[model samples]
Target: MRDPLTEKPRRKIPSRLIEVDAWIDSSLWRFGHGFSRFWESVTIFSRRFRARGLNKLAVEVACEGLTLGVAGLIVMLALAQPAMKLTANGLPQQTDYSVLFLDRHGNEIGRRGVMRADAIPIDEMPDHFIKAVLATEDRRFFEHWGIDFFGLARALSENARAGGVVQGGSTLTQQLAKNLFLSNERNIERKIKEAFIALWLESHYSKREILSMYLDRAYMGGGSFGAAAAAEFYFDKDIRDVSLAEGAMLAGLFKAPAKYAPHINLPAARARANEVLTNMVQGGFMTEGQVVAARRQPATAVDRSTTTSPDYFLDWAFGEVQKIAGDMPHRNFVARTSIDMGLQQLADESVEYHLRQFGKTYDVGEAAMVVLDDDGGVRAMVGGRDYGESQFNRATKALRQPGSSFKGYVYAAAMEAGFKPDDKISDAPITIGRWSPQNYGRSYAGTVTLQTAIAKSINTVPVRLSQKIGMDKVAALAKAMGVESNLRGDKTMALGTSEVTVLDQATGYACFAAGGMTSNRHGILQLFDTNGNLLWDSKRDMPPRRRVLSETASAEMNQMLSQIPIIGTARKAQLSMTRAAGKTGTTQGYRDGWFVGFTGNFTAAVWFGNDSFRPTNKVSGGGLPTMTWQRFMEAAHQGIELKPIPYIDNTMPERKAPKVAEEGDAPPPVRPASLTTAAQKVLAQIGMLMSSAPPLEKPEKLAAAAGDDNAVGRR
Candidate 1:
């Protein structure tokens, strides 16, 4: 109607203006109609979804999908330029490296290599080494591109089940990409960059070239960067001359460099190498016979170029670092250790002093010692006679017979079973299932107190005790006391026939000084990275104490053992400055001698023996081990105040009611023989207020009530 009227009125205006007006009205009307239809359709769809109870679900799914799509788009855009630039660069240039190890005081104890190991061409490496790497690291190296989709799927499944990252399924190419270009952080951005670089590597280089570059630049542990360098560093041989076992070990290092490091942990390295050999067999890279032969000839790491007193400490700290944070870098880092350099120096000097004095006379070729605080902080360690002579850490790695030093655990079990220190035990020759146990001097005391038996380290007493209270109890007690080695469960175990590392023995012995509170011996108090970030701290990370022995039993055992440094086998180990309790152990054939002792402040263990297990002419634990212990303890406790250990008197009277003070007349002088001076005063003060208390039970009855013994009705 308006157009008709306008046309009639358009005589005054231009005809094109009237035509434009009609077109605008028609376009607006069409838009309005279309909008009305869209709105109606939306309303109908919403009503249907609500009726089906699917509206919220649909909205949630749509929002999640849209968010994921947007995030993926953003990630792609962010990584595009870096990925392109990395692909253009093709390969990263070499950089300098320096790994500093700090002592407890934050002083640099030693520094590893400052330069990267020399790289070699891939064509020069032996086929066995290359095949070992492929078999152990990635069996589908040739079939996959930069990433292994199947492995990734499996890893995702495993991580989801674990509820955290427990597995990393990065391919060799991806590992090369990460090590070459990206930081060692586990995050989305870094992972994306790693994937992109891996793809770039796969596209740019041939398989052989990629393998060559990877092998040349890979970290093979012990501060070695390439396969060639690792071969040289571990075996002191060229890559072409490395044996199958050696090559397998090198391949195993790619998974965990410090864990499988030969110089750091030879047993772990050998075990990992055995795994690699098995992988090679399964992957058809080597025959079963070849693996057996290779295992027979286990690789021996060459001596390190430089050595220090804290070399063993450094190795221990490195292991702790692995436990705290996996996938650590070889260089550009700092590991804070619990090793007290001053104590370490003192221990080293003391070992050398003993070795030099009696090494020739006693036929002692090697000796190791470990010292720990009451809380199990490893303050000092002497791994071997000389680190340059052999890098094998006997203090923590070597497992030899603990001998009579294990008697403490046996006696502790007996004491917990209601046997008192004053109880008499026969020390005559005893036979159990065709096994006769004799004293060290081939003599017997017939009958003696438990204190005397333990002080003299009479073999027959513990053997008979083990027989009385099942060998299983002894084994359990030993394990509870922190002895990690396997026990024989035979009568001979009473004589310490089982072999145990000095660290385990020392840690177990420390429980006595800690009043039966078991602690794990650790050489790392805290760890700091190159960026000064604290990785781990023992104060916050220490595990809960495992109470293995009752306080009364620990005190009684200490009383019996304290005599060892006074009138027992380790008499020479007595410290004039402080009271010490310890045991002396001499193996059957005199192949190993041990002295493990503890003070109120510290605990220590020493081993003296030949690495070849050759018997010394007349070497016994009472001689060299005691001397070394005395020297080290003397130095360690120079300025520390003398503190008496927790001890219980076996001669204390039975349960009796105290005479109470009458009407605040004077507190009855509660003079208990077993109580210390300070304890007596406190008890007297309490006696003044409690005038009609019940009689106190005996120590044994108290132990029974507390379920610390094998009393009837006790748990």
Candidate 2:
């Protein structure tokens, strides 16, 4: 208002604020001078002290010790974070149920889970059993708080002397901590957590309580947990009545259950038991005279070696039960599964026999098989060669390339798009962008019918057909059929580059076996409570089946697939009693080989490969997989009345004798008309090479040629 734009205005400072600012400046200056003087005095004193060599050494050592202590604290805190996240709400409640699984015939096949009632009190256990465990596992159980440093040192010394680990350093408390709150991983973090948990356990529970929990929590193999369960499982007797010899054997399993379980290997179990007896005598818990008798006789487990545990089936069915009754209040359940023990045994034997017979020759180490009834009931499953060595369910869990077997869905899509089995498609090499799929032999057949193309597994035909009908439609049809695995809509989809499980293959093939209806695949047929009250029934709870394919389309697909076991890549899969139809799939590099076939009554999918993903010795679906499928199917179709495949004739035709050619008369030469110029040139070069080379009479040379021939024709 007073010509502010041209005038300079000044604000007056308060006297109290100016005095406060001066005081703060004076205080800071005084503090800085005093600290400087203090630092100078300290520096002179430290230099004087360091002038003496002994004082300097002492200071250096002190600094190093403090640095290490700080670093150690940081590492400890980092490792403790995982354990600290666990709530201190006492030990977790025993939610494990005592599930008793039965086969389709109501036979008790096996048992799983744990029950609180199965726990045996410490005082009730046999005196010798308790002594044996204490002597072998932790001789200083009463001497140490939680971790036994002296025992660990002794074990380390012994292992150093032996140049191999012969004794475990973990105390019983540490083992209990691992079984309770930690995984079996052998990392530093897990070890730290285990030690911390062990200390916590010792602080909260008494010696007797800790020992009892240890005996009840450790896994004792054969799907049994705890000493009480092991005693009953191995000896068929209660823990209180276990004899000294049996107690020794049971104690031996605490170290390595799978390696020393008597049912698995009696010799190894006895050896481990003898070692336990020696430990008892050495620890002064028993006199040599008392243990000698037990060592001589050892222990004899019940004769369960002949009984094959349907562990894979039980594992799968258990998951199904959990899905169906996860919200139920009842903990204990009796699941009647759809597994037929006989068929299960057959499947197991067939897989094992083939692997043992040809596995080494073919360099295939593992195999999985799944069988289902026409109604989608899972009849049998073999996850691997041995359940003890590996628990990963390959039948239901392993995702492998299905190879050419996936062509069925593509063809089905084609059928739905108004293509016929007799529809002609060019099998010549065709490229969609940069991808040009070639047949297995690198040879193309000329214009061929859809049936002939699928039977022969001509790769170019399906790729062309998929491009025409659209891969999205093919993927939708495959999902509708029952392929639960995710399918990619890339051009390679028609070639089955996508991976699926053996169970998925079986389920999808079962849809075809069920006359194109949805395959409501299920494992658990019924669930019952302890009092026998029915809780869930699969027949009532399962969703109704829906139609996935029209009748004409389904029949055409069946007709095309039926040629496989007869004249296609799966000739070995033909059944003696009934007609079989399926597809053969061989992945790139022969890493996986599959034969998924369906009969009028059953559908089975077989896979052969190495668990490590190593390529086999050129094992193809037309070889071992189909052979195993044939073996199982022949045995599975023995007594039951055969059901005909939908829209297909099941009558067995008479076999005609082959006509013998006249002497010195050669058969006419045949050539595929769809061969590309490049393929023809390659064949011409091979012929020239063969004509100029010497006869391949040597076994190795012949084998090499034969191997090349096999690879060229693989499905």
- What TM-score, over all chains together, does every model reach? 0.53, 0.71
Leading candidate by TM-score: 2
Candidate 1 lDDT, 197-262, residue by residue in tens: 888889888888888878877766654567876787788898888988888888988888767788
Cα misplacement distance, residue 438 of candidate 2 (Å) = 4.8
Q: Tell me, what's the RMSD of every candidate? A: 26.1, 17.0
Best by lDDT: 2
Considering summed lDDT, which 10 consecutive residues are worst modelled in model 1?
662-671
Put down candidate 2 lDDT per residue, 422-492, tens digits, no spaces: 98989897888988788888997799999999999999999999999999999999999999999888999
Worst 10 residues of 2 by lDDT: 706-715
User: Once all C-alphas are superposed, what RMSD does model 1 give against the true structure?
Assistant: 26.1
